[model samples]
Target chain A: MTTQASSTAIDAEAAGTVPRLSLNRWTFRTTPVQEFLEATTSRGIEAVGLWRQDVEEVGLDALRRRVDDAGLRVSSLCRGGFLTASAEADRAAALDDNRRAIDETAALGAPTLVMVVGGVDRADKDIVGARARVTEAITELAPYAEQRGVSLSLEPMHPMFAADRAVLSTIDQALDIAEASGSSAVGVVVDTYHVWWDPSLERAVQRAAASDRLLAYQVCDWNLPLAAEPLHSRGYMGDGFIDFPAITRMIAATGFTGDIEVEIFNENVWATPAEESARIIAERYQELVLPYA
Target chain B: MTTQASSTAIDAEAAGTVPRLSLNRWTFRTTPVQEFLEATTSRGIEAVGLWRQDVEEVGLDALRRRVDDAGLRVSSLCRGGFLTASAEADRAAALDDNRRAIDETAALGAPTLVMVVGGVDRADKDIVGARARVTEAITELAPYAEQRGVSLSLEPMHPMFAADRAVLSTIDQALDIAEASGSSAVGVVVDTYHVWWDPSLERAVQRAAASDRLLAYQVCDWNLPLAAEPLHSRGYMGDGFIDFPAITRMIAATGFTGDIEVEIFNENVWATPAEESARIIAERYQELVLPYA
Candidate 1:
């Protein structure tokens, strides 16, 4: 793999076309890693956000080589959080796992590790305590991630997912935890699907940018009649209720010149051919997101 | 119905027990209004928050007489704000409907009119604009409500409902709108199921109380594996992940000795006999919430 810091530049063929748009691998959920990379590159897409499973499936080194060969940069790792487990042993195991994720992110040359911090344990009812544990875990992991030259990107998932996916449900809350970590390695992800409904979003985004904690931005739409599988409810830009222009303007205003990852998790989206999905994502990015960005 | 203002004291039998337990009519969703009122009173419930449909179905005067006969005080009215319509005529209609609701609340002797402010219109994608519209509508309605001695209680819904139900999805946003209204008639409702995931809830509650905007308190559990129909996903107090004691403690700390309305919208709870549902609610309130309050 080319040993350069993650680049936001598009490949020669894709140069000058939505350069900051990265096709998140989960958008092609069922595609093989190599094929997804090929499809993304063939569609003039120059970067991607990979999941741990995708790296593990083809072996990390091989995946990294394939990504490099395709002239694509890794935007950010899919996840490395789940640190809200209550048991000490479980919490410790989670931290060890996160450290491993940090190494993988570094090895891939990704600058940030997207973290979907854990929610309340099924057996536990203390969400406040669970959230405190998440803050504590991030504080402990921040230094280790910093030592590896990686940033821990805290993702504030939608409130619907607060019970099982992530306790950090707003950008402000993520910023609070990130600030408390007292390490530059700690930052926040502003994913439109999770935060588009926030009334305080403008202020939160400004605060995140002011503190230099706005590390990555993800785009997707918040569709209605929520999908049967809530986790997979995201839709392509402009296909749902999100006003990408308004939110994108806020991100652009922050001077955030980074990859804007398009991460859709809908089952219908997964059923599309990877090339078709990539093509549509690029076109939608041009019409809906790029103007504001 | 009892002619005096909404009372927090439970009926004689329930007074020494859970004195502030108010049975929200939606907990008996499918039950007839008269029967629901009788079931609530027989369970020693002294107060109730009602849905407009419940009053209209039986005729407002008829329902009022039924509530008075049952020795129940009307705690609050279920709704009165869908003011996010983009069209002038639609918005005007919404305000007119809200005025009617306020009059009904006054006639029923309820002190508060719960407002579920409308979300973005299905045909539109301007959530920011929609939210602004909500603020404006409430500002216009607050004075009308104040003159009638009714407080317009803004119920900030869960973000999942931000698309089809309410655009105001956080207590702080509701407070901002309420405070801006510059009317004592403007206030907020703290529903545990909606605000439980908010990391800033403790501070929000404190602020709401300090400003005397804490008009009502609603309780219901946020159950996992969300129901098939999300609108009907609420469970009884002890049946889900919410920490009632902690949240209740915050309200108590504010000296909010107001009615604690148990408002569950679950299909399963509705399937249970009305009496049985009321019994379980009273039992759970005592076991999980009363101790803290």
Candidate 2:
């Protein structure tokens, strides 16, 4: 599958077409929905990824129409799954919530719904058990997501978050769950910040693309002198140790033509003006991400 | 091989012999060697693990004799390997230092020299290359360690430390290097704080034990709201979210009767008196670790 995509992508690139960037809402999470859209429009960015909370604050339909009117393509929705609860009632509630998230993704016309699989069960630190629960939950939801026309993109968060945030700690691990679902609606995400440290990522990205499961391409640098929270230590494209071009080349090698989403979660970044942040992010994407993408 | 160990350990346990705890120096890093010794001696703690810096500060020979006189056995030396240098001169220097470290371990009568194989190459973010360097360096040093009768135990640090600390981040990764050396002198350290999150740890521990490569067993909990240094956030046994009995059972299943080293690096733990800290750590280990061991 990737062979054709690779050749076609090369042919297209040689013909002068290039991939575009999708600015994730978490990059400027504090900005109001209207102002965030204005910032994207001002930067001439056609693609934007929205978080669940952001759409909720603005009323989903209102924000959806605003994005549609502004000609902004909804590349992906920020989140969905927290299906690791042990109790049947809690687990059922998680599935219900994810169903709504899927509905919202379709409502916003987003192509994908990114899922951060819940961490360990609260009463015990059984990571293996938690992962099993995640797989079970994704399997149950994949068909629903397929019916709703929004692919479920499972994200492998950094291993540091394995204990408290997401038990899915590697792209291969996420792919295992997605492939087990045996549905095209289930896919995997390649977030550079989460996966750059993986020794097997180069080959894993190739496998993901070959399987046609590479649903989203997310980029963010990982910084040193990590924040106390660890979550807020994600840096701007060029501000950290990640070799962007090398990793981007890995994705490109798989013939990925998806949005190269910039998804940073930094406290200092949140303090910047939305418009200025968008402009700077676009510039960084051009210089650091576009050439390879 | 694990089957043999399991049966033998079962027989031994049936005979009433059990594992013991070794208080790591970092568990009382701020205490004077004499005070640390006094605290351990008073508590009837028979084993301790010393850091390179601490040994260097007090003079290696003096400390060795002190441990002897105090009737305390050295379980394993704190660390040795930082052999991830790309340049020949730097790499050669690293080898020299590791040789000295082996000599120090032999001098101290410690059976194992714990190795934190250094991070990615300084000039590039090539973890793959750095990992290769670590293997090559370990291969070169294995014979020398055998001659010195000090087994080189490769420690797989948490993935979060991959960029700036150790390249070995999984027990299987360490075992690959250890087994490749084809020398009994090469082994692996199973530090719960580092390897607890690994999905394959249960199986990997079995492999390590079967190969007779389980040279040291270290314990420490991972706390949330990481310390400024990140490294200093290690909690006492029960303070963090790790399921101790489940993991400790993996080690015991391997029939590992070696010292169960308490290796916490928390700031608060360091602030207490060495005697008080020793008492608390021992208590936690008994409550959280002993039943499984």
Candidate 3:
């Protein structure tokens, strides 16, 4: 599988095409939606991962029309999961917001609604309990997503964000939740930046694939000394310690033909012009990642 | 097991005693070793986990004699594993240093030498390769450690440290490595700050206990907005989002009677006077952790 995919990707690149490349808009958060879409399309990138706030900025209908006009595939909606709210009102608001995110995902024709399960609540030291709440929330959202013909792709974030951003911190845990949701709408993402350090990644990815739950394959490098914001510390592929060939091969081996999205969260990358960032993403993805994926 | 241990701890604390509270020296790295020891003993902390640099400062023999004279139990040595060195000479030197650390652990009458298996090498991007090297190093050191009657405790550091500090990033991975070492001298440390985010932690802790590989239980809280030096970002037990009672119960349920070492690495905590830090450790451990442990 890897051999065939590697050769095909190489052949396509040699023919002057960026194969399987998708630009996740957060990679250039400074760019407005219109320009970001224009930049992505100008570079021949056919797909993008959209964030909820960005969608809201232009309004979902306007953004959907623009994405359609650009002929860009919405790979996956950027978020909709903070399900760890302890207060009844907050929990309701979160779920209601997630429901709206699912509607937006369906409207945008995105197959998956990327979910970052909420971290431990303030005044709640129970991470396990918080994870349980996330699981429950996923169960609740799964049916709605299935009804909308969209999948809820659970993103197990880096454990550094486990306390305050997302308690779901491993592919195994995400897969478990996805399976337990018992709705085919539930799935898991294989984001290199998040799960690259995972020891059982190959096995987890295999399991995710076997279960048909591998929704998105996002690429980014894990950088050091973490940015002052930490969340924006991700580097461009090949610029950091992640062995893209090894990890990408593992994902590619799963026979996953999904868009290979570049979702770097670096402030430096964000500061770069969208076109330049798109060019680098294509270049790095071809050199470091495409051969494997 | 949890009920009995929990009640016993509660009873002990009700009698005005801080049970199972061992002060890990790095908690207050600013204090001189002599004053650190004095402060520890003065606070009625019966055991301590020592750092190699601190021991080297006063010389091993002198520190050993002083600890013995103070009637302090050495729970475990701070560290001895940088097995991710890619060069042959560096690898040999790291093993030799670990052997010396095993000797130091024996000399101090500490049962275990904590091992922080190194992260990716300077020019290497292969984390999986680094982990395999760490496993090989542990296998090689196990017999020598067994000869010295000191266990090599593999500590799975937080994933945040996976890039630059330790590739060993989960309790399950550490336990797997320990088992593969095929020596009783190989064990694992359960450090809350590192593994608290683990969704499989309870099961992993149980596996460690079932295999009799639970060598050390270190307590510290997971603080956010990580300090500039992330290594020093750990907070006092109750100050962060970690649910001490829950995590402590998991350890205590393992029937682990070893010293529950307090190993905070926060700058503010380090700046506090050693006496005050010790007092706070005792107080926090008793309140947030002891009953569960």
Candidate 4:
């Protein structure tokens, strides 16, 4: 329940070993699971956020072994819970998929599973209805996630993604659903790229922290004049206009000492050699994000 | 304070003559003011949202006379405020320009002057500071706008444009500033292109309308997978996935009987001849927007 104003001193670099950056698999999503794992470890990163795609390819158990052997903690699982389907069969299927994601998160020893609750139903303009469905879906999954020791970290994507990706576009909105669920298993992801434009973000962070619902924190720059494939246009830390120090300061004020994942989706960054991408992430994370964290 | 639930019926065809559309000057930004004026009136459109560039070229008096001669109403002025500047001189300069804009809006018989309250200062990531400056700048200009009988319509642009355009990114946030100014002259522009993704839009529209602060409503679909120059990527209705009928229904619930401006910034739409663009806009307006409003 920490709502401390952002600290102005004790820079992460000077403090040392405290505020380590986590790498999400999506950053080097183009690379093989094994190669990516090795690259992250070689850089001495402490934790990673795993997308289901990589785990599926390598098989969950084998992937789990790889993460454990590399001494990397899973900050959160990539995603689960796209509960906005129109069909009876499809809606039921989302629950099953989320159940699997929770099991995998628990299996990987990850405390949280990031949930980018899906977009509205086809031709469905009822975002309210779609959002209601998300709440209902999470309600259904909350118990299962709790049973599996996995928290559903609802990730509010940028509003630009509201149409095609996630209808949840603000931390406070995600927190609203989290609160209504009445379960500790439900939480919110305070991703900088997704929420930097939020005017009430500082207060939202305080609210999340007070409720102890701040689950995972992700970082990346918002590419100015947003890129075409918005899912892929996220810039490395210092490359865009986001005020990392300020945003990270908000998260830090929440007393959230969890992994700050460098979850970028830029095409150009991903197109580069995986190793190079890892290096850039480390540099930016230190220069722009770490000091503030 | 009409807090009635959104109207579920009275489709535009049945309601008729009410909720007339306003053609924004930027839709045909390349065309001469005279040509643009003729194209709009030819379609029997009753109102327009004039851009400053076009109005400047035609000279304020000539454009005002032309609008008057055609019996077309000026829905609102294109823009006035850009107060985000690090230097006091630059900011003072913006205030000077906005005063002139307020005078022009008065001369043109427009009730409101849209203010894209500036973005972050140079190399400054402090969006919070920039947003504060907008409130201050608006407070400074609020009296001038009121004296001229023109409301300062603070437009909350889409978050994508937050870096380089309006720091205000939500209807409620805009209304907060409008309310804080404590003046009838301070109102908000409910531009769908900028605010369609807002989860709080429906409620904010009602709140603004209740406060009698909703001075304008601009319509344009968000180009899915936002375009490069977000400033110009706005799509004609139906070109993107915005649920206009639903959004307009929300606005209508607020009892906002005003011009719905078709303010597309799409390069493709602009590339079309001004007359054809008007034709397309009218078609989309009738089918997508008018039904609900």
- DockQ ranking from best candidate downward: 3, 1, 4, 2
Which regions in candidate 3 have their CA more than 4 angstroms from the true location? A1-7, B1-17
What is each candidate's DockQ, to 2 decimals? 0.74, 0.59, 0.82, 0.61
lDDT of 4 by residue, B1-293 (tens): 02332243234335532247889988887787889889888876888989888676888888888999988999998888789886899988999999999998899999889998888764788898998888888888998887888899898988877888878899999889988888888989888877887888888888999999988888988665666666776898877767888888888788888888988777788789988998888877877777677
In candidate 3, what are the lDDT values of residues B128-160, reduced to their tens digit?
A: 889999999999999999999999999999998
lDDT of 3 by residue, A1-293 (tens): 24545677767756766878989988878998889999988877889999988777888888999999999899989899899988889999999999999999999999999998888986878887888888888998889988999999999999899988899998999989998888888989888888989999999999999999998999899888788877877899988888988898898788998898899988788789999999998888878888777
Window of ten residues with lowest summed lDDT in model 3 chain B? B1-10
Q: For model 1 chain B, where is the 10-residue window of minimal lDDT?
A: B1-10
lDDT of 1 at B55: 76
Error of 4 at A54 (Å): 1.1
CAPRI quality band, candidate 3: high
lDDT of 1 at A73: 88
Q: Candidate 4 recovers what fraction of true contacts?
A: 0.66
lDDT of 1 by residue, A197-270 (tens): 99889999999999999999999988877887887889999888998888988998999989899999999998
Q: Which of the two, 1 or 4, has more TM-score?
A: 1
Q: Estimate how well candidate 3 is docked, as a DockQ score.
A: 0.82
Order of quality (lDDT)? 3, 1, 2, 4
For model 3, chain A alone compared with the true chain A gives a TM-score of 0.96
